[model samples]
Target: MQKQRKLVILGDSAFAEVAYECFTHDSDYEVVGFSVESAHLKRDELFGLPVVPFEDLEKHFQPGEVDFYAALVYSQLNRLRTRLYQEAKSRGYRAASYVSTRAFVWHNVQLGEHCFIFEDNTVQPFVRIGDNVVLWSGNHIGHHSTVEDHCFVASHAVISGFCTVGRSSFLGVNVALANNISIGADNWIGPGLTISADTEPGQLFKGESPAASKVSTKRFFRLKED
Candidate 1:
């Protein structure tokens, strides 16, 4: 049997815990510890492992011995995760990526480091997923699509064929993109919105919430008075 690679996750939030569960059970990596910035180090232990300070991480574990995964969500439009990923690389630590066992990625897919692709994701042929990306459950990346670096795509998003999602974008759940659509950098596409045309950089798209009916539920349904 092959030995599992040692890994350290950088963060202690919900996403970090989820990453721990996925990497521990599904991947060929063993999570040994976690690290956070010194100012934000709220706890000393997590999941029975030590949580060390990022400033002093090298004193605890050598970069050559352990790989790192920045398990952060799309905070600051993914700039936080991108910064830490680049920092870890600058410190000579290899960034780790996780593709769930149940995901169907084509043989020719080009996936970059520090990415976390959850279960039920269908990545078709000729797809290119760049670094520090998070594709949540049940997303569809059609053939010839490109999701650029530092992007976070929530569950059930559909990127059709020949689409290009630009860097640092946050795609909300159930968002769908038409074929050949090109989304510019730093976009925030809200849930259930469909993008048919190309988008400009730093655009924000959200659907307006529907207003409630004026009539009461009892009157509308013809219920008897109490």
Candidate 2:
């Protein structure tokens, strides 16, 4: 068997832990340590590995010897992750992308740097996903779809074929985009929304949350239980 590639993960947040678990189990990279900013450094160790400061990561782990993965969430509409990804690039460190082995990504699909595609994501043919994009589990990215940079697509979102999701867009859970639709930049698409037409830039579409029923569940069911 081939030797595993050593990796240094940036950040120690929940997303960092999740990224570590996935990379450890499903990918070709071995996570050696984690790195964070000095001000945000709370602990010295995570997952039984040393947590190095991002400012001095090269001192502990050489960039030439190890690859780096920025494990950050969609804070600031994914701008945080995108910023760190750029910092890594400026430091001459190559960004690592995670595409789960269980995801059905087409052979012709093109994915950019620092992308995180979780399990059960079905990416159809001719899909082009840009840098620092996060695709949570169970999403369907249909054929010829283009998801631009710094976008965060939540679980169960369905981006139909020939759709174009612009940069920095946040697609909530269960959101559905119809075929040939164009979602503009920095749009916030709320949960359970169906976008059949093109959206303007910086639009915020919020779906109404389900209201609670006046009657209790026990009274509504009316089933006798001894």
Candidate 3:
């Protein structure tokens, strides 16, 4: 086996833990430590590794020696992740991308820095994924689609062929983008919404919740209890 690359994950949250598990088990990355901002540092240790302040992380782990992965959620339409990724790049630290071994990514697919593609994701040929993008489990990225920088696509989201998801966009679970559609920057797409046309920038879209029927299943089936 090849030697594993030394890595530092910049977060101490659930996302960071997930990153550690994926990188450790499936990839050639060895997680050395976790980090957060000094003000947000809750504990000194995580997963038996030292949790350091991100501000001075370079002092402890040299940029040339260790790579960095910004493990963050889409708290601010993925803008926070983008900012942190840029910060790591400015510090001369190499950003790492985690593509799960279970994911089916085409050879022609292009992925950028700090991307996290989870298991069961099917990325088709000619797909272009930009920096700091997160494709959660079971997502289907169609052929020739472009997901721009800092976008977060949740589980089971289906992006059709030739679609363009703009920068810092957040796609909720089961969200479906139709063919040739364009999702604009900073757009927040709620779960189960289908986008068939181009969306304006910084839009908030929400799907209606399902209402319960008045008729019960037992009544509808006309089944008698023994």
- Could you give candidate 1's per-residue lDDT for residues 1-226 as a string of tens digits? 1337999999999999999999998988999999999999999999999999998999988989999999999887787898899999999999999999899999999999889999999999999999889999999999999999999999999999999999888899999999999998877787888888898766767665322234433343343442
On a 0 to 100 scale, what is the lDDT of residue 143 in model 3?
A: 98
Q: TM-score for every candidate vs. truth?
A: 0.91, 0.89, 0.90
Candidate 1 or 2, higher lDDT?
Answer: 1
lDDT tens digits, residue span 1-226, model 2:
1337988999999989999999898898988999998989999999899998889988898867888888887676666777788887788788888999999999999999889999999999999999889999999999999999999999999999999999988899999998999998777787898888887766667647332234432233342321
Candidate 3: the clashing residue pairs are none
**Greater-lDDT candidate between 1 and 3:** 1
Task: Write candidate 3's Cα lDDT for 6-77 as tens digits.
Answer: 999999899999999998888898999988989999999999999999898987899889999999998755
Clashing pairs in 1: none
Winner of 1 and 2 under TM-score: 1
Off by over 4 Å in 3: 209-226
Q: How close is candidate 2 to the true structure, as a TM-score?
A: 0.89
Candidate 1 off by > 4 Å = 1-3, 209-226
Q: What is the lDDT of residue 33 in candidate 2?
A: 95
List the candidate numbers ranked by TM-score, top first.
1, 3, 2
lDDT of each: 0.89, 0.85, 0.86
lDDT of 3: 0.86
